[model samples]
Target chain A: MTQLQGAAPLGATVVAEHGPTDPRDQRPVRGRKKVGIGKVIAWIVMVIILVITIFPFYWMLRTALSSNGALYGNSTSLLPADFSWGGFERVFGLQTVDEAIAQGGSGAKLDFWRYLLNSVVVATCVTVFQVFFSAMAAYAFSRLRWRGRNAVFGLFLLSLMVPVIFTLLPNFLLVRQLGLIDTLLGIMLPSLFMAPFAIFFLRQFFLNVPHEVEEAALVDGASKVRVFFSLIVPMSAAPIATISILTYITSWNDYFWPLMVSYTDDSRVLTVALGAFRAQSPQGGPDWAGLMAATLIAALPMIVLFALFAKRIVNSIGFTGLK
Target chain B: MAITSPGVAHSAPNGRTSVDARRRRPDDTKLALLFILPAVIGLVVFYFWPLARGIWLSFTSWDLLSPSQLIGFANYQRMFADPVFWNAVQVTLWYVVLNIGIQTIVALVIAVLMQRLTQSTFVRSLILAPFLVSNVVAALVFFWILDFQLGIGNQMLEWIGLDRIGFFTSEEWAIPTIALVNVWRHMGYTALLIFAGLQAIPANLYEAARVDGASETRMFTGITLPLLRPILGLVLIISVIGSFQVFDTVSVTTGGGPVNASRVLQVYIYENAFAQFDFGYASALSVAMLAILVVVTFFQYRITRAGQTDLN
Candidate 1:
């Protein structure tokens, strides 16, 4: 899985003692030229794959910016057709119903802003409390010594194996029984306290914390809780931030559970709302431009977060994927 | 957050001995309980309880309006005979095969290329951009881009002297198309995982191989593949598990449409529980899915030896 083919040409050059002046070095130079061709081919392949991966996002933006009316006529155009903000205006309910219909939108009141607000509220609540509580539990597992701690941690690990779908139905029922259906609290409740991954991730980091520091604090009469809150939490801020970004993204993008529980606009999130928007198209067909605009908006927060924490998020993928 | 040196009043006379004994036998049971209570409560209530209740509910007949009646293995029997469930199983397996097969190969290639070519964070971030988008967003973007009437994908096909393919509308193409859409979203993240694995393989192994004039292919197969087994096993298991539960994209794009061609098991379960209110049947189906996953995971672990490492 690694390529050291370039080393062959280098080895050839190293073996040629007289460098470029020697006839033997000419052969190595030709070999080096061949390696250059291989490098060019590899670079070409990388660029193609990069384009495939990134083009759809650019396409989303282009389509979002295009006029809905001219989309079909200019289907093959790489540039936006009839350059218009009508799609976004319709999505944000900034256009009159007549103007929306003229632009090929369904003109249905989407409550896009409300869904955005709901997503923010739900994601924030889940991320903050989940990370905080999971960190506390991780502290217990990693720092404090107690009987059956491994057993409990093992139980949490096992929970990771349980598919989310298996518990999804019952969780919905539980939330409904609590009369939190169609409320932001219901969307946030199941995830608010702790997640198995969060605890597991934090515990992994906490295990690496030096015991000497905590011991020093204990000798100074600092309570275990104080050490955790003051010393451990501060030191573990990087991992905490990583898990927080992850939890926030997951919470924000969750669709099925929210779809099950939230019926009205009052509790609907951007993901579910976008689905509803697509299905709510008029007889003329879906407002493609408007839908793309809404998708872009729904995806904006994540894209922004990714931009800000791209390195952190990309680096965390290796750690999270292994789990 | 500075821990100020406490006065003598705070540090007791026995602090030194207690610290030493604590080192010998630390028992913070009471504090541990306090720290762990919230998570324990969450686990028991949200995860463990619902799991048990879901299993129990699987054996009963209920439709939300009436009290559930214990029906023993009847729900399981119905599931066995249900054609839709069977179709869903077949569809899901096909999807898993396609999704995991294509995704793993592509990701491994990309990971290898990245390892060989450049360690550019910019390139990795660009590849991972699609994954950062929510499934709904990815689905909708693809929906519009692949739209049969005006989608640029079809237009390009036409420009290339081919017929326009109904990506989401046709029965044969829906599952494959959906799988590809998801592949686009997850391949980068998967590649990065394998790349991390690649990074862990000691460079000295490659150096020694080069010294012996081992070809790149030989080095990769002999050295890299063996050392990378644990991570490959892990990536496969994670992706397979995730692939089996393909919901968000399907839900947003096709809603398991075109004669239920894209109706994977999760969609089937969601429809049964929410649309039809057949909670018992849904629960039974979920239990079946869980059992299959457990078996699959066990076999994968055995075959891959993911728990073991070839490296010393």
Candidate 2:
């Protein structure tokens, strides 16, 4: 475990070691005269790649802001021409003109709010349970010396390669047998049990915690559980945050598992709800504006999370040896 | 970050090794068991039991409404004869190859470029942004953008005097198109992994090579490729495993349609179990997938290890 943790930070350490001499640090000032045709080509390729990557989000936002007429009509404006909040309002369950017309007399009885709430509730439960259990297991695997520790840890690691789909059916049956079908608990249960990946990642982080800190706590007569709660977890905040973010993102974005178990608005997450909404469109094609709006709503939390913790998240991903 | 330096942490072990200190404590075994119990129970109930049950289920016929009867090797025999299953296998393999092949190359190129750039944070975040978007939303975005009539993809193609392609509707293009979209969504993540690998290469080695008059191309091929072997293996393993399990995007975009062009194994399993309600056949398919995965991973390990030795 110690060796693994040591291996993990080699990249970070080398990057740090070479910081002062890195060509990147001096490139801006001295690179102008040195820019060859090759350099120019590289930059152009990079920028084009960047544009391709970022353009979809831009297009989604533009479609979200545009009226349904602009998307379907002959105008074909690339940008938002006439701004409209109809899509957003409809998603938020405020009866829009489209909804009123679509339902003929009464407004569309969309359960967007309920779906969003279910997503939130499920994602939160999965994140909390997965992280908490993973931390305990990781601490035990890394810090505690026991008879069967290596064997247990090895089994967990081996299970990491098991494709989740392999277990989906039988797990579904198990959940159904437990009478958890169509409940948020049913949707969340499969993932709420922390997987091998989380344990492995957290174990790497826990191994990095200095032995002396825990030794001191132990020497001072603090119990193992108390020491773990008070000292180990607090010191391992970066990885804890990383796991929390990852777990939350995964739980939030999960579609198939939730779709399998959840049937109604009471348990259906935003992704499944959006999928049903898009599929149930009357004719022609899906409501582009409404779909885009819902996509944005589903995507915004993750975007905001990336904006807030891009560095931390990226570093954790890079340094922890998780893909 | 501060704790990562094991060298520093190792030197000052308070003059008492952890094992020696641990010997004084007798309650540690019980405490450890307590700590690991939840995870252990979770794995048993959620993973191991289900895994065993899935294997057991493959021999039985269960349709949610009726009692399951064990008919040994029946599901596997049917699977071997099923043309749809064969088609699914072919489609899945194609998707995995294209997805991994495209993503690996693109991510490697981007990672190398990212290493040279100064404003990498902005670029990295922008590139990784799509990965955060759920598969459902990603499929929707690409669905609209790749729409035959209203899609911007076809619009741009027409502007360039090429025919508008049916991304999800046509059999020839559907699988490849979905693979491309999957690549686009995940390449950034793969790039970051490769970037970390690039960073870990000691700068002094490149400096020494440059001083010895090695060309940039030679340096990259000789030094970078060999050194990057391990992380590349990791990336390939992750990509292959992930792509093989493709379901969400396929379900949303093609519904395995236009003639089963995009029906990968997961989609096949989903349809059999949920739609057709044939739990036995689905379980058989699931077992086959698991077997294939294990074999593929073993080969991946062997090949990457072989590459490491050849490079050395």
Candidate 3:
């Protein structure tokens, strides 16, 4: 029944049932060999749906690898047309202005390397600090018995309902007044310390932790802070790691707030950079090859991360979605 | 002791009364305050303060250059009179309806299929791949694929001897195109959420029904649908609230264009706030959006009874 709530326990059960699970194992269910016509039809439909879901990603790669001039003539080709690394070269500013223009690029340097660095910095700072601070608050809310704890936590939870757009204007103004506008600091400030979701997620985990361990630590003269650091933090590492990954992805993918805060390549993240790149369509139309290359590059980090931590990320989605 | 130790007897072991255990601890209030101070400070300064200031800024007129002057519902009055605002509201609602409707149905089918058939992690990961990328990437990829002249989508249509459709360029197709793009991005994630709920349904129920000679369709309608209501309700509310704030995709693809056909509320508010520098009016619009979401959420909660579960 623990499977009813979270993916973690489900994953654990799977691991126990099948030793050292392989993600590629596509074995059908045991004792379910009665493949009716209906089942075959279902499998066909599922495959078709899967193809539809995955085809665009393939198309993006195909277009990115193709030359811009060749894309117009071979629009429907399955493979890359006039295959070249020119699109990626243009995105990385490896091509000279004339070379870029010759390849149908805007010839305007994208500063993609700078934006990528900016994204790394902003996402890392926001994820590390937000998760840490939220965990501390979660510990207070869940483990400690204190006056006004539930009320304060409830107030934090209520803020979740306040759509982020409602606060955008004021927060933008505040960031500006703090002289953080057009800086990485501005992009990171609003989300730097805590998120209600992070707190709620951690608090739920903390609530289930038996108090006896903490009580034992206290009896041995450890402070509450020490107990939290030494006991709770290590014990709840899984939830903490889960929250960190989620926060990192969110921060990396964030467009709106960063779009408002970041104006130049110095602080502009990949998402905003991609948006700006698309908006500035030179002569004939957008540099399709270059644009696709940049989009793919921008999405690469997250894709790689998802690939590495697919199980953990997938499991956490169940927990987050239900919340 | 009686009042303080209502239900916490387990912690007081080894001849320690609950009151004695409590007395051994340092001041919890001070420790809690210390623990929560950083998050609380951030929440107040960034979230709570901004929320209040946004509400206040709504009632005043500020153009960034001058001091905000009290305008007393002038922004709200202007919004009510503004056709563009109404058009934005309409476009947003239409987009939400399309997004939620299509996303929900597709996700449900996908979820049911995954539950009944194989449980391949590879398949689940593939379904969730689109969601991992940012909206900008999804929009750009789709925009290129769905371009009017040179797009592969149009090329395929022409191959079928059908007239090419202007996906983002035509008003008729802009909202739907944007909606569909987002649907592609979100449906898999939503399906996973529903799939989790489906996992919770007991196999005994199915076996019991099978023994009673119930058909698959009959069991699905009778057991699966009823059991999945709480999850479905929660997913719907989450999806609807998210769909209403559709900004990134539309902003990237159409910029609310082909003539205001996809000018979602967020886009309109952003334009007023940043482009026009009409912060006051933008604040009012945001307040309006917030009110709508709150009311909608309340109604959805009441209608879905999302808080209640049939499992127990």
Candidate 4:
């Protein structure tokens, strides 16, 4: 600012008259050359902090790449001495994973494949079913005027307000009655099978949709079903996608219910599988490398997904919830 | 907006066919009903049924097996009488308070820092990493970090001049440690929310304050704090709700131990339902928890809303 051609004549009286609030207070003054050195210092400090934030992720990938031999050596190497695909190979292959499991060398050999499959299955199923139910409910509540509509919506809101555990007892019993215990469905069926938050998010999105779109379709002699299927559905894709991502992540990481339901590795999701693995802690001899490797394997999927879609997730929350 | 009258609207007599079209037609009520039915039925079967059964079971004296026998509030009476029940409540209340307080303050500070690193997208994303991990993963990760033996927490303590803290072990630090882990896992996400709220406040407001010769800290107190009440209140409420229903960390880390010193309401319910097979007792405990949360949350909402109106 001081160096600008027409900015100032370098007198206190004139400078105070124009930019007296001290343009350097807090908000960065764009196009100002005087702040260049300060900005560089700030950038360096920020980069250092950013490194601290990203180091854990680097460590996870590093441990995943390290071989069993390199791991057991316990050498304090930031970079791997000998990298191998053994852990991931073992995680993905049933036979390799099975032999390891049969021996049970380091506690219970986790069938990581089974857990991953279970997680994928449960997450996909719950996300699909939950989105369908919530969209329907939200559309109905928001658009349809029927007997006891407000009352029913009130019940939905009340249910949302309460902690979900209030209904856990009944849900457990219901699942038990249906013979779903120890099944993938059992873990996925509780909070999600009917999620109020989904309904809430979806309805808000649906309400923001225009009445004219459907009315215009109807005016053109288009059937209601055709209109909804064609227009409303396409328009609401963003909210539905948001709900799907949120629901999938939630179902992916669900713990206690799965722990209570699944008796063995065949039925357990990654969360419970990892949990049971950690429970059988190698107390006497700590296998830090293996434990870290296993944790990385279980955690990698969600971390990658989150990193890629973080902006979408945050913006999605702002979008879906605000309406 | 709508003039709904079934009588004297139209008569489908001879030559009244076209005339009927002139009268008001039925609204798109049927389509709306169709839209809402899927969610309604799902909730009814999965949520409402279970909720009713749970509430009813609170009055019965039954276990996992056999039909529930009505016992006229015996479970509630017992819950009220038991000292352990109160202990769990106290710990839970403390957990809720401490978790909300610490998380709110830290999240606010972090949000402020994040806003400062406006030019750095990596730092913003970095701050949000822990939030991306699920609650269980966060708890498990922290559990590993706080492991008494080879844990990073203890390692850090050794690196520092201080003695090792028993984090999730010794009765004294167990609950607080759980709270800290909870905060660490959640702070990034909460801070992200608060940071959004802060960013949404127009830059011109702060500039105006600055032009009025307000100091940075004063501008924060007068402008930022006043504007951030809604988001802060939300963070406070949600954190409280999350803490009240806390079961994952208690189960994974301490096993509610050093003698259930860190036991929360959910854990208490878990023990009753699973260990004792006292589903009736568990139901009663859950109902009590529901009532307490509703009352507390309602009060908090009212308080915050009232403060907002008063400030206005």
Candidate 5:
């Protein structure tokens, strides 16, 4: 137990599973701590890399804040010289490019708010349905005894290798044939059910739950359905949440399918909108400040979600790998 | 994903299944099917059926408007003969090669450094920040930052009195630029994987090597790298698979580029299917992609299986 305590301080379940277990894991030398050149070098390297990783977002924010004149000005200032909210206003439709230009401001005419709402709706539905359906299937694969179970599971594993592109064109045809084209439902229905990777990841997590716990519930006259809802769901919240976040991110970031199906602003998501918005700019190129503002607004939810769940997201990736 | 026997066999300990448990097996099977029905229906409709139909679509001349005509192997022949297809294949392979090389080295180095730190959530989160952003956003950010005219990248070059390079407008520089953005977006996830592998290595091995007066570089080469083989293999396979399907980045930024320099396989397939309304040809291209992936995945599984050790 002490060894487990010393294994990892936070996000320990994933690390604990992968952590060295044998006594040979312990070092002969211990209990010495001081600053060293190696430590300094590591910090320096980390700091430098961190800056590089973060600078792009900082630049996005900085550009989003600048006025159009300031952005295309002769001098490229290191700071936001002409900071304003006009770009974001154009994005939200509180102001339009014509209105801004008429008043000597720069803006773009985009259905940013509509796209944001569509992204949220699609991502949320995909997350909820994908998690529920995956959990149901994972439960069967991990705990229940059944005929042809291994065969069906094998099909799932095999399909994992089939690059989504192959299914994509045919599936698009399927959706179009069903007369579901140009609708958000067409964009959402294909992937909203369950994914092979989600099922596999969840199944691995479910397999780790000991048999005794479920047996105990069964002995108390609990049906399999009862046991699943009463015991499995409660015990597997961590992994379920992890799967939910992953699904939401993937669905929100999804561009190709949405781009294929959605043509009008009524159904277009942020990613597709961003692309259309870019192409709609005047001859000189996109309005850099307004474009940056739209980009930030599109990315803000994910960045915030990532910030909040950084540890779990990392651990989920580790857990998926270890399996 | 392999269905091992342990979970089932372990439940009945001592090789003894009571008569009651044996009798209950049928009920378990029934309940299992019930629980699995929703997903199974989805898989048949969306996954397996589409895969089989995609193959059939590949043989037919199904443009979006007209009915499909049965013309077996014609799509393949046309694809093989087409210069654009060949260019796409060349572009995709080169992108995969360069992407894997850059991502593996950068990720491994970052992982090694991260493993040395005691408390690294903040730093790790910063590294992971880009990974969370949608690829479109990442491309857009890079699109502006690497803009030939007002780009910070070129601005910095001007500050240093160096020639401003054409990032997306030039044939030679475009693909590599896109590949670099791909690396920047994904390196953190791979680093975390390798970092996890590092943590699982027993410390006594390092201590023993130190007792023998081994240099740090020797210890790294002799122990760390070898122990990291499995995780590194996983990273390599994943990077290769992902790089091959490069679409969003290319579409949003280059749109297959300044002279089709970055016309990756996915973008190429997409254009054929949607833009040109050549569903059969698009399906053929997708099949080609699947074949390449299958071969690559087979070799990866074989190599990893052969070099298998008790990773944990």
Candidate 6:
């Protein structure tokens, strides 16, 4: 039991069937600490790269804050000189941000609020359905003693490789026939409802759940559904959280389908709206400050989430991909 | 997803099947079906149904504007004969090549750099911020930066001694620009993946290499790189699949460009289905792309799996 203490945290040591019996893995391997020039050089390179990676985002926020008139000015400085809430002012589509909010507009005619609301609705609905169904399917695949399970899973895996383009016309036609165009339901139905990857990922998670626990639940008179929702759901937080974040982000940022299906601003999500805005810009092109502002706003929610859950998100990609 | 044996194989210490569950399972088949009904129905409706429709649609002449003619293989034949489709094919290949090449190199480098960090977790998350910014938003951000006059790239170039480069307008630079934008957004995800693979690896492997007094290059060539084969293969395969389906980015950034330089397969399909309403041709094109992707991905999986080791 003591041997499970130091196996490179998050790279959690494989606790075997013997229930954590390995002594060699139990001792912490304090990795070599660097010193002098090597340490300084490594740190310097790290900082520089971090700056480069983060500079685009920094520039984005700075550009968002820059005045429309001042943006055209040759400014080498990272920080905007003439900073105002002008871009925010423009997004609200009023003389001031407050005035724009008082009206129907969130900040502008097509500011953050409407699009944010659309995104929230789409993402939330997509996540809930995708996760729930994926979980149930995953449970069945992982637990059910059904015939042709391997073949079914293999087919589903093949579905993962089939790109969205292959399914586009068919889905579009289906939606059109159903008269779901320009509806939130249209965008959600094709993708968010059920993804093969979601099933695959959750199945991987479900496979890891020790069978004894579920057996215990079964012995205690729990049905499969009860065991799943009550037992597995609680213990499956890591993978569930991972999938939820993934589904939520993917849904929020979805572009191609939304662009293809929706015609009006009513059903238009952030991606499609931003896409059309780019398409219709004049020869002089899109307003840099305003566009950047809009992009920043659209990206803000996920950014905050990523910042808060960076570890899980990073590890989630690794985890989900590996699964 | 560390799935070992599944939960169904649950057995007691005495090797008897766990009791009480099956005895009480009410209408067993019905209950199982009830639990799985939503998923089964969902797959049939969303996936299987659409796939079947798409396959069937490929067999007929169903242009949105025209009468639904039952023309078998003609759409496929026309696609094969058309140079336009071939151009789209070439652009698609270019996009895939560029995405794989740039993202692989950048991801490897970033992964290596990230591995060197004393604080990898924060850096890993920081690097992955781009992944959250969806294709549309990322493209819009880049679109603004690559605008004809107001573009930051041109603006910066003008400030320097160099001439302002027409990133989007120029045929030569347009495809590369879009590919670069994709690489920028996705490289971090690949890097994170590689880092996870790296982190997952037992430190003793490196320690053993160090005991042998191996050089850093030798250590990487011997231990780190080889160990990362499975994950690297995954990243490569996914990048290839994703690159071929490059749509939202290109559509948002260049709209298939000034002279069709950036017109990838998905973009071409979109152009056919949505833009031109040639559903027959579009269906044929989609079928062709899917066939190619399936074949390519199969080989990729085989090769990658072949290279995989039982190191973990």
- Recovered fraction of real interface contacts per model: 0.53, 0.44, 0.50, 0.29, 0.51, 0.40
> Which stretches of model 4 miss by more than 4 angstroms?
A1-109, A145-148, A191-193, A282-287, A319-323, B1-27, B119-122, B306-312
* Comparing 1 and 2 on DockQ, the stronger one: 2
lDDT of 3 by residue, B1-312 (tens): 011111122333446434534885458889899999999988899899999999999999999899999999999999999999999999999999999999999999999898778687778888888998999899999999999988989988999999999999999899999999999999899998887777766666676677788888988888788778877888888888888888999999999998888898999999998899999999999999999999998899899887566665
Off by over 4 Å in 5: A1-36, A101-108, A321-323, B1-22, B302-307, B310-312
> Native-vs-model 6 lDDT?
0.72
lDDT of 2 by residue, A196-308 (tens): 77887677667768877877887787877887899989988867888798888988999989889988877889999888877776555566777788888888888999999
lDDT of 6 at B45: 75
Better of 1 and 6 by lDDT: 1
lDDT of 4: 0.67
For model 5, how does the per-residue alpha-carbon lDDT over B1-312 read when each residue is reduced to its tens digit?
A: 232212123343624544545567788887888888888888999989999999999999987787789998999999999999999999998888888899889899899887766435677777878888888999989999989998888999888999998998899888899999989999887887777767756676666677888877887887788766765776567667777888998998889988889998899999998889999999999999999888987898688652343333
Cα lDDT listed for each candidate? 0.83, 0.78, 0.84, 0.67, 0.79, 0.72
Winner by lDDT? 3
TM-score of each: 0.91, 0.91, 0.93, 0.83, 0.92, 0.88
Q: Which residue pairs show collisions in model 3?
A: none
True lDDT of residue B283, candidate 1: 96
Q: Evaluated with DockQ, which candidate comes out highest?
A: 5
Cα error of candidate 2 at position A242, Å = 1.2
- Tell me the tens digit of each residue's lDDT in model 4 across B145-176: 56676455576788787888888789989999
TM-score of 5: 0.92
Q: DockQ for every model, please.
A: 0.34, 0.45, 0.42, 0.22, 0.47, 0.40
By lDDT, rank the candidates, best first. Answer: 3, 1, 5, 2, 6, 4
Q: Rank the candidates by DockQ, best first.
A: 5, 2, 3, 6, 1, 4
The true-structure Cα RMSD of candidate 2 reads 4.6
lDDT of 6 by residue, B281-301 (tens): 888888899899889888997
List model 6 lDDT by residue over A38-146, tens digit each: 6577678767767756777877888888765666664445787478676666664545646533321233355557777888898999999988888887887776655
Output the number of the TM-score-best candidate. Answer: 3
Give the clashing residue pairs of candidate 4, or none: A140-B36
